[model samples]
Target chain A: MPYVNVKVAGNLTEDQKRKIVEGITELLQDVAGKPPESTYVVIDEVNRENWGKGGKLLSDKEK
Target chain B: MPYVNVKVAGNLTEDQKRKIVEGITELLQDVAGKPPESTYVVIDEVNRENWGKGGKLLSDKEK
Candidate 1:
């Protein structure tokens, strides 16, 4: 079984989160050969200030 | 620098979760050369019935 984790910006709507989790679970179950029961998915959201990319904070860089 | 994902069972104490996240972050940073801001972690919990391994549910297999 495979465990799946997702990291995204903190502003996702509940619907988005739900769809993403379910999608990932299915993907892992089929692609990774993980059992449905053995698959776990976690989502972590971070503030723009806390996330950085390309040498700048995501919030700052995006603006 | 890196997006770190941890796949773990449910029912971890907050302390265990924190330690695991921090440890994974450090490992990714050191091993993958990812910046601190680029690291993210998520935890997911599932019922044993939903998780299977070795042709059996983890909860059932363990029991």
Candidate 2:
């Protein structure tokens, strides 16, 4: 089983989540011959305050 | 940089999130010699309907 984890700095609509899940599943299946039904896509809606990049939190970077 | 994703069936409190991040960072550093500063820990709270096990949705399993 292929486990895919996607992290986003903010929220996503249900439609967006659906599209992302579908897209990732298709990509893995096409590129690596993974089974779509067996692939697991876990999306994380991370708070900007908790996400760090370039030694700074995303929230700080936005300021 | 090492990226770690943790998937949970339910939500977590802010304190719990903090501990998980800290614990994972420490584990990676001590076990794999990864740098805590550059390591990324992301936690995803997945809905029962979206998570599947044994070809059945987790929501259905609970019913």
- The model with the greatest TM-score is 2
In angstroms, the error of model 1 at A39 is 0.9
Indicate the residue-level lDDT of A54 in model 2: 95
lDDT of 2 by residue, A1-63 (tens): 888767899887766766777788788778999887788767678899999999999999889
Best by DockQ: 1
Q: Global lDDT of each model?
A: 0.60, 0.78
Q: List, residue by residue over B1-55, the lDDT tens digit for candidate 1.
A: 3354646444556776676566556544453344666666666656767876668
Q: Which of the CAPRI classes, incorrect, acceptable, medium or high, describes model 1?
A: incorrect
RMSD, one per candidate, in order: 10.0, 7.1
DockQ for all models = 0.13, 0.12
Can you tell me which runs of candidate 1 are displaced by over 4 Å? B1-63
Give the candidate number with the greatest lDDT: 2
